[model samples]
Structure formats: C-alpha cells, structure tokens
Target chain A: MTAYALLVEYDGAGLVGWQRQSNGLSVQEAIETAATSLNGGATPLATAAGRTDAGVHAEGQVVHLDLAADLPPARLRAALDFHLRPQRIAIRAACLAPEGWSPRFSAARRHYRFRILNRPAKPALEEGRVWHVPLPLDAAAMHDAAQALLGKHDFSAFRAASCQAEHAIRTLDRLDVTRVGEEVVIHASARSFLHHQIRNLAGTLHMVGLGRRPVSWPRELLEGRDRRRAGQTAPPEGLVFLGVDYDPPLPWVTSDRA
Target chain B: MTAYALLVEYDGAGLVGWQRQSNGLSVQEAIETAATSLNGGATPLATAAGRTDAGVHAEGQVVHLDLAADLPPARLRAALDFHLRPQRIAIRAACLAPEGWSPRFSAARRHYRFRILNRPAKPALEEGRVWHVPLPLDAAAMHDAAQALLGKHDFSAFRAASCQAEHAIRTLDRLDVTRVGEEVVIHASARSFLHHQIRNLAGTLHMVGLGRRPVSWPRELLEGRDRRRAGQTAPPEGLVFLGVDYDPPLPWVTSDRA
Candidate 1:
C-alpha cells in the first residue's frame, strides 16, 4: 500500500464543501470517486488539511490518500485529474507521502485569502469570486486594527454557531488587509481556525474599515468571549484556502525535479 | 442633443460581440436598450471604439451616444448603469463628448491583451478567461520574436478571412509578450487592427515560443502578404479590449472633481 499526498486547487462554487454530505456534491466525494475509479472501483479515503465551506475557493489545498497499488507520481496525478474531469477540482501535484504524514494532523499552518470588490459597479469577471461592497473601505485602518487579534487567544466571539471544535483557543499568526487596485484583499494565516473565525473577523474588520465600529471593538469582543458581541460573519463566497504548510516538507515538492 | 462619451467594461462570455445581432444578445444591444428605456422608450445609437468578437472581454471599452436630453454626467452614468443591471456590463464613467468626438474615428490608439495559461492541469479560476496550453512555453523567445512584426507594414498574413478592411497596410505600434507566473500575457497596441490580427499574431508567437517555428518566421509571413502563411487565429476567449485613447481626453477624466 502507498500513502500519496496530493496538492489540489478548486473552485468551490456549487460544491457542498470539502466533506461528503447528503445535501449536494462535494469536493471530497469528487476526489474519492476519481480515486476509486483509478483504483478499479475500490473506494479510497481522501482526507484534506481543511474541510472548506461551500462557495469557498482553494488555490493550494493539501490532501492525503492511500492506494492499494503503487503508481508513478505523475501517472497518479494524471489519472486522478482525468477522472476529475468537467469538475472545478484539480490535482496540481502528487507524490508518495513522507512516513505516516497526514494532511489534517501534520499540517503546521493554513493560509486563507478573502477578496472584497470595493466598488460601486457590480463585479462581472469576478462575479461569484468576490464579496462586492459598494462602499469604499479604508484598508490602512483595517490593517492597523487587525493587529490587535494577533497571537494566541480564545476566539469564541468569532466562532460559528455550529463549530464542533472542543476548544476555541488558536494562535493567529497574521492578518493583513491591503488594497490591490480596486479590490481589498485580506490574508490570514494560523495554526487552525474556528468554523467561521476568518469570515467573522473579516466582517468585523469591514465595519472598522467603514468607520462604523471603533478599532478597539474587536479586542473588546474578544475579551467578552461572546459571539453576539462581534460583527456578522462575512459571506463564504469571498473566502479562499490559499495553501497549507507541513513540517519536513512533502515529496510532492522534490518529485518535480525527479 | 448631447454626444456623450462613456467609459465601459464588460465580460463577453455569453455576449454576441459588441455589435447588435439578430441571433443573440450583444453588448451594444444591451446598452442601446438601456439607453432607450432611460430616454422614454426612444432608441439611441451606441457606437463603440471597436466591435469586439464574441467571448472577448473588455476592461476599458469606449463608446459614444447622442442623448436627446442633456443631463448631469453623474446622473447619466447612474441612470444608464441602473438600467444596464442584470447584464455583465458596467458604465465606468460618462461625460459630454469633446465637440464632435466619435468613438471609432476620434480614437488615437487601441490596446488589447491576450492571456495564455501554460500548465499541465486545467485552470479552474481562469477557465474561460484564458487560453489553456498544456505544454511548456518559452516566453522570452516569444517576446524576442514578436518584435519582428513591430512598426508599419502590410499584414495580410495575419488578417481574418472575412476582414472588411479596404487596405492591408497598418502601422503596428507594439506587440509584447511577458510571462506572469504560469500565465503568458500578450499586449498589443495600434491605431487600429485588422480583424483577428492580434489573435493570429498570438497563435504565431505561440509557435515561436514552443520552438516549433523560428523567431524570424513572422517577418517572413509578413513579407509574404498571404493569410495562409501565418498561424491560425487564437480563440476569442483569450482576447480582451484593454482600452482606447483619444487626442483630447474624454470628459470623464476632467469631470471627476465636479
């Protein structure tokens, strides 16, 4: 048996998120189905570093699965991708796993980017890909206020109502907001996040950027440890899983040279 | 009556080019209908700087229309944009034209951009926005070869079969190719272009970048003055009308303060 690590990118529109659900089609089911087809109708377990929500995009998502038969990394990627055809999922790279590496547990960090189209006109090319805010935002003020949430803290105020995490404590390494042309991009990196932590943070910061809420509002809400004290959760459409980082690196990186 | 110059942007995915067609919806028809509704059901003429092909996007398209009632520039833009809702079009700005300014005739230069996704896997986010070439391409070689077609010369080799131009002679201002990460971007600028000229040039440059054709091949094809000697026209999906320049700047530039 071979444990293979795969790098994935996908458009999460119309998807039922990363986990398999009875509600609709999912990115996990798509990959598992493709992997099953490649394994000659045998089902394979496909686990990702993070189970993203529906309408959330990903540029560099990591997943790990075990196969009964060994195949060349290139062939494995090619075959799985071929099977994933017509879907918005792509296996960017694949290679043998390092020891007993698991995407969810072994992941050191996860990165996310949320895009906001801060313009009056409706977004056309970036229709479903961005959160359109007709009002202009102050990116500099938002960035400054975002620093208050840095380091380890109990992020209960930002947690989703249905989050299943036992503890709400997590270290937020970075939260950056910058204006790229007419769009405001927010980048967040952390060990892990609560169900809707990033989106809630985004929504709260947007209020500060718009001057409706004070810069000290987030820290006060964090002190309260109450979800009701924070702003609304930003929509899922603007969020994207940028990538995941693992310790000791994976063979998918070096396999390209070989 | 006032001849207003309008700055426009559109996503041409389901559009039937810039001109009105009986078969399907066009950007021109959308704007004309919107203007007619705004003008109390009286149809108005909407002339564009260039009639882009179907599936050809535009970032800064220019258009001119004569309105019976002279309204404030802001109101005109707001009203037209309000009416153009539910369509993949945006009136970026609107202002009175400079005397007898016409979008096509008074335009000094037109700029276009073509995108090529060079990768092994199919692009998800940029699926229809770019031409996916599942092979390695040398962008520097393409850029070096593209310079051979710069300046004025007869370009029948790159003209479309149904091009309705009186002469094949045109002054080529610039043709530049650059690599942006995994994508190859081609920027073309000229006073005007023969139909499908940029697409054909991009296809020819792709051959040069792939090492299938020599760098000097474009110059040879130019000298031949035969359409059969050049490469095939690139798909319209990869093409975008960047913008058009006029001698006296459009009123939107000066009307911003007022």
Candidate 2:
C-alpha cells in the first residue's frame, strides 16, 4: 500500500464539516467515496491533519489515505475531485507521501483564520462567509488584551466542556488580531488545540473588544482554569482551517504519476 | 413643492432596473412606495440622474423627489430608510435641493463603473454581485485598445438601436480600463451616455482582451454607426453606477439634497 498526502479546499456551508456523520453530508465522506471509485474495491479511509466541527470552513486541509491501486497519485487526486465536485470539496494537490507519512500525527503546526465583519449592516454579498456583528469594536484594546494570553498556558478557562484533549497544556506560537477596513482578521498558529480552543479565545477577544471584559482578561482566564470561567464560544461560521505544516517539504512530483 | 436630492445605495438583484416595468419590480416603484409611507399624503415622484439597467448595482445614485410635507430633510431621509429596510434599495441621504435642482436636467456629468471578474474559479461568495468569466484576459491589450475609441466621436456603432438620443456625437471625458489582480475595473465618464453605451463598449473590449479582435476594433466600432456592428452588450451584474456629479465643494456631505 502507498500513502498519499492531498491538499483540499472546500465551502463548509454545504457540509457537516470534515468528518462523516449519520445526520448529514461531510467533506471526508465525499473524498473517500471518490477515492473508492478509482480504486475499484476498498473504500478509501482518510486521516486529516485535524477534525473540524460542523459549519467550519477550510482553505488548505491536508489528509492522507493508503490506496491498494496501481493508479498514480495525481490521477487519484483528479478522479477524487471529479467525484467530489458535487459535494463542493476540491482536491487542490495530491502527491505520494514520504516514508511513514500521515496527515494527523506527522504535522508540526496548524493555522486558522477568523473573519469578523465590524459594521452595523450585514454583508450584502458575503453573507455566510463572515461573522457580521452590528456593534462597533475597539481593535487596539482587543489586540493588547490578546497579547497577555500568548506563549505556553493551560487554557482550560477558554476550553470547551466537550474538549477531548489529553492535556490542556499547549504552546501558541502566534495570535494576531487586527482590523483591515470594515473587517477584523484574526490569525492564530499552534502545534494543536483543544476542541473549540481557538473559537473560545475569539469569544473572549470579542468580549474584550466590546469593553465587557478588562484588557487583562485572557491572561486571567488562562490562569483561572475553571471550565465555567471561559467566555462564550464564538460561532463556527467565521472560523476556517487555513493550513497545516510539516518540516522538510516533500520532493515528490504529483503530475509525473498521473 | 420643495424638491429634495437624495444619495442612494442599492443591491440591484432585486430591482427591475430604475424604470417602472410591467413585468416585475423596479427601483422607482420601491422608492415611490417608501416616499409615500414616510409622510401621510400622496406618493411623491422620484427621478434619478441615471436610470440604471436591471442587475446593475449603484453605490451613489443621485435622485430628486418632491415631498408635500413639512418634514425635516434629515428626518425624511432617515424615516424612508426605516420603512425601506424591508427592501434592498436604501436611502443613504436626503436634503433640500438648492433652488432649481433637477436630478436629470441639472446633472453636468455622469460616471459608470464596469467590473470584470477574470479568474479560473468562480467567486462563491460574490455570486450575483459579479460576472465571472473563466478565460484569462490580456489587461494591457484591453487598455491599449480602449484608447483608440476615446474622445469626441459619433458613437453610433456603440449606441443601442433604440437609443433616444437626437445625435450620436458625444465627447467622452474619460475611458480607462485597468486591472486589479484577476479583476478588471473599467472607469468611463461623460456628460451623458446613449442607452447601453457602456455595456456595448465593455462587450467590444472583452473581445480585444481575449485576442479575438485587433487593437483598432473598438475605434472601428465607434466609427461605424450601425448597432448590429458592435459586440454583444455586457451583462448588467458586473456594472455599478458609481457616482453622479454636481457643482462640488458643497461641504462634502453625502446627503441627497445638495
């Protein structure tokens, strides 16, 4: 069996997110089904860099699946996209994986982006693509407050109750919250996170931005560690998985195999 | 009767253009209904600087309306917006016109903007707001070709067959086409335009960008007075009535009444 790493982009509005669920549609099921169509028999099972919740979007989601076919990685990728097109998920790039390569355990970092529309009016065109908040927000105050929560921390106070992480201790490499025009763009990078960790932090920042919580609130929440002390979780609509990183870029050529 | 000028903004998808249509809803009908609701009496008549076509958006549409009430101009404007909130067309501002103000007759110049989305992938978020053409366009060629048709000329070939203009001779103040990333923004201004003039120009330019026509094609079309000679009219979705001009330096207020 050969392992392949595939990069994917998708519109999450039509999805139940990255995982397969009995309730509705998902990106994973679509890709797996598409891959299975090319392989003739075995249903393709993929492991992603991370499992995102319902309503979350992704521009660069990395996944890997072992195939029992002689078909090339590029051909496999193209075939998968052909079948996945109806599902709104696209396979951007696909290549043979390095020795023992896996999307989940082999990733070194992950990045996420959250967009906030900071206007009194709703988005006329980008309706579901952004979080439309009708109230004015102080960006500087939120940025200053966010700095206190940087570096290593046991972020339980900002962790969701449904979080299944083995430990709450994690290192946050960067958390930049800045405003561009009428929208707020939040960039966050980390090794990994507890369930809804980044989303919960967004909620805390929104609280600080609106002057509901003091600027030093995030640091206090980190130190507090009580689940009930966390700010309300931000909605899933505005959050997106931007990318996943692994050191030593793969030298495999995708087109040659196809 | 006191005449008031109003600056307006609207999402054109819901409008059957600016004129009253027997087939469906029009921007004029929407505004007239709201104007009548703001004050008790009869429905006021509304006229705009330019009667934009169906699916053509506008960020700054200049209009004049006569109200038979003692309502403050600001309150009249705000109340109209409150009642018109259920509709897509919004009254950005309303003010008492400086004596002898007429939306159509007093206008010295008019400007129109046409946006072209040239990308391989469709804009999922901006579906109805833009016109998506997948083919790659040569922006420099389009710009060079556009200059040949600039200046005073009998734009007979560019004017629609049913254009009501008494003469085809009109001086074009400006005709510039530039690129912004994958999109091309065309800016053209004149004292006034013949019906479907800009759309006709855009259609011919599109052919030049695609290398289907020579740089002199736009000039050739303008020199030829036959409507059947020009390229097809561009879709209305990608166009916007950017702004209308009056004698400037009047406090820079966006109020409809200058």
Candidate 3:
C-alpha cells in the first residue's frame, strides 16, 4: 500500500460533508467511487485532515489515502482527478507519501475563515455561500474585544453539545475580525478544534458585532465550557478550511486517493 | 421635469441587451416600467452611459433620466433603487443632474474588462459570470502584442460585421492583460468602442495566448481594418463596462425636458 497526500479545494454546498454516509452523498463517497473506476476495481479508503461540516467549504483541504498499487505518482493523481472531473471539488496538488502518514494526525495547524456579509439586501448571487448579516456591526469594537480570547483556555462554554473531544482545552493562536466594504472577514488559526468550536465562537463574536454583548463575551465563553452559556452556533455556510501545513521535500504526501 | 443622473450596476445574463425590444426583456424596459409605476402619472424614460449588448455586464454604468417630481438626489437614488430592487440591475448612486448632462454625449471615455478563467473546470458557481478557457495562456505575450495596438488606429479588423460606426479610427488609451492564478483579467480603456471591438480583440489576443498566432496580431488587426480579416467575437459573458468618466462634480444635470 502506498501512503500519499493530496491538496483539495471544494464548494461544500452539494456535499454531505467529507465523510462516507449511507443515506447522503459525501466527498469521500464520490472520491472512492471515482477511484474504484479509475483503478480498475481497486477500492481505496480516503481520509482527510479535517472532516468539515456539511455546509462548510474548503480552499485547501488536505487528505491522504492508501492505494493498492505502486502506480506512478502522477498517474494516480491524474487518473483520479480525470475521473472526478465533473465534481465541484478539485485535487489541486498531489504527491507520494511516507509510510504511516495520516492526514489528520500529521497536520499541525489548521486555518479557517468565517465570512459575515452585513447588508440589508439578501445577497442574491452570493446567498447560501455567506452569512447575510442584516445588523450594523462595529468592527473596531468587535476586534478589540476578540483579543482577550486569544491564547490558551478551557473553552467549555463555547464547546458544542455534540463535540467528541475529551478535553475542551485548546490554544487559539489568533483571532482577527475586520471589515472590507460590506463584508466582515474573520480569520482564526488553531492547532485543531473540538466539534463545532469555530462555529460556536463565530456565533458569540457576532453578538459583539451587534454590540449586544461586551467584547469580553469570547473570553467569558472560554472560561465557561457550559454549552448553554455560549452564543448560538454560527451557520456552516460561511466557514472555509483555508489549508494545512506539512513537512515537505518528499512531495506533499497528501495523495489524491480518488 | 427633474433631471437625474443614475449610477447603475447589473448582471446582464438574462436580458437581450440594455435597450427596449418586442422580442424579449431589456434592462431599460424593466427600469422604465418600474419607475412609471412609482410616478403614478407620467411615464419615465431611462438612458444609460453605454447601451450594452446582451450578456454584457456593468459595474458602474451611468445614465441620465427624467423624473416627474423634484426628488432630492439621495432620496431619488434610494427610491429608484428600492423600486428597481427586484431586477438584476442596481442603482448605486443617483442625483439631479446639471442641465444637458447626456450619458452618451457628455461621457469622455469608457472602460471595459474581460475575464478569462484558464482552468479545466466549467466553473459551476460562476456559471454566467466568467468565460472558461481551459488551455494555459501566455499573459505576457498577449499584453506585449496588445501594446502595439494602443493609441489612435483604424481598427477595422476588430469591428463587428454589423457595427454602425462611420469610421474605424479610435484611440485606445490603455490595454493591460494579467494572469492571476487560474484567471486572466484584461483591462482596456478608450473614448468609445466599435461594436464587438473588445470581443474581437480578445479573440485575436487569445490566439497569441495559445501561441497559435504571431505576437503582432494586434498591430496587424489595427492596420487591416477589414471586418472579415479579424478574429472571431468572443462570448459576451466575460465583458463588463467598468465605468464612464466625466468632468466635474459628477454630472448634476438641471433639465430633463430640454
């Protein structure tokens, strides 16, 4: 079996998240099905650096999988992409991998972006792709308040009710909220996240945007892991996995399994 | 009669150009009907900076029209925008114009943009927004060749077969082509354009991009002037009227019935 990694980009609207599902279509299912056809009956299992939520998008999602053949690296990537050409997702880059490489565990820091478009008109074209926030937000105030939530914290209050992590403690390396024209971009980086953590944080930060809650809302939520104490979970549509980091030179290792 | 200058933006995918017609919808008819309904009596006629062809978009299209009442500049713009809300077109700015401010006669120069998405994908989300040209393109060569056609020249070769312009002589102030990742943006500016001039230029330059035509295509086209000798007209989807330029406090016209 060859362990390889691949870089991916996708519009998440049509996907049932990244995992395999019996009832709905998923990125994994699509890739595996395409791989089955491309490899001439060899079935491959695809794993991702992050199993993004159903409506979440990705510009640089990383994945790794084991292929049964020692096929040339380029052919593996090319054939899978060729078969999966019709799909919305794209395998931008791919390469061979070292043995035992796991897209999830090998990832060090994951970057995510949440977009909030604050305007009155219901985004006609950009709708369903971003959060159409109708309220007037004070970006400066929201930014100043977001600083307190930086660094390590218990993050229990902002934790989701369905999170599977054993501990709610995590270090938030950064949180940036800024406005450009009618759109507000929230850039956040972390080692990893508990389930729904980013969405939950986005929800509470929105309150600060509206000036409903003080800037301390985020730090307060981090101090309290009680899910009930946190703001509502932000919509999944606006979140996008920007990319992942890896030790390079031996190729991306993030093979395009499909 | 009140004179009003309107700033408009629109996605021109559905309408059959900006003018009125019996066959199909035009942006002019939509706005005129919408404004007439708001007037409660007199019918209003709308005029635009450029009477764009079908599938041609505009980000800043200026126009001067007559209204029945003396509405404040901001209020008039706001009301017209609110009334034309349902249409794909949007009125970004509006105000009473200085007397005799004609969108066509008063305009000094016009700017247009063409976007070529050089990618394999058919661009599902941006369906009617960009033109997808899958093959790789050479931006520098296209730009270099494009520079040869700048300034005053008889562009008979780039003129459409049905173009109504009496003369082929026109000065091209600028022509810039640049590649950003998978998209190539071409920006062109001039006093006016012969019908299909930009589209024809794009087609000829595209040949240069693919190394199919010599790098002197632009100069060759400028000298040829024969419509039959030019390149094919590119699809209208990729073209946009960036804006129109005028001297002074932005076109405050005093009379509409003059």
Give the winner by DockQ: 1
lDDT per residue as tens, model 2, B1-258: 677787777778978999889988888888888888554668888899899888988877888788877677767766776677776776655667778767777777888888887754444334566666657778789889888877889999888887888998888888888989758888989888888999899888989988999988888877777889778899888888877787741122322333
DockQ, structure candidate 3: 0.20
Tens-digit lDDT track for model 3 on A79-185?
Answer: 66667777777665677777767788877788999888775434433555788676677888778777888888888887777778899888988788999876888
Query: What are the runs in model 2 whose C-alpha is more than 4 Å off?
Result: A1-11, A29-113, A169-174, A177-179, A189-199, A226-232, A240-258, B1-8, B34-36, B62-115, B149-152, B165-194, B225-229, B249-258
Docking class of 3: incorrect
The number of the candidate with the highest TM-score is 1
Residue pairs with colliding backbones in model 1 are none
Candidate 3: segments with Cα more than 4 A from true spot: A1-4, A20-24, A41-43, A68-82, A118-125, A134-136, A226-232, A249-258, B1-3, B20-25, B41-43, B63-65, B69-89, B119-127, B249-258
Itemize residue pairs with steric clashes in candidate 2.
B5-B256, B5-B257, B6-B256, B7-B256, B95-B257
- lDDT score for residue B208 of model 1: 91
lDDT of 3 at B153: 86
Point to the candidate with the largest lDDT.
Answer: 1
Candidate achieving higher DockQ, 1 or 2: 1
Chain A, model 3: TM: 0.92
Model 2, span A1-258: residue lDDT tens: 778888777778878889999988888888788888666677978889989888888877898888888667667766776677566576666778888777877789999998887754445434567786657778889888888878898988877788888889989888889999768878999888889988898888988888888999888878989867767888888898988888876543334422
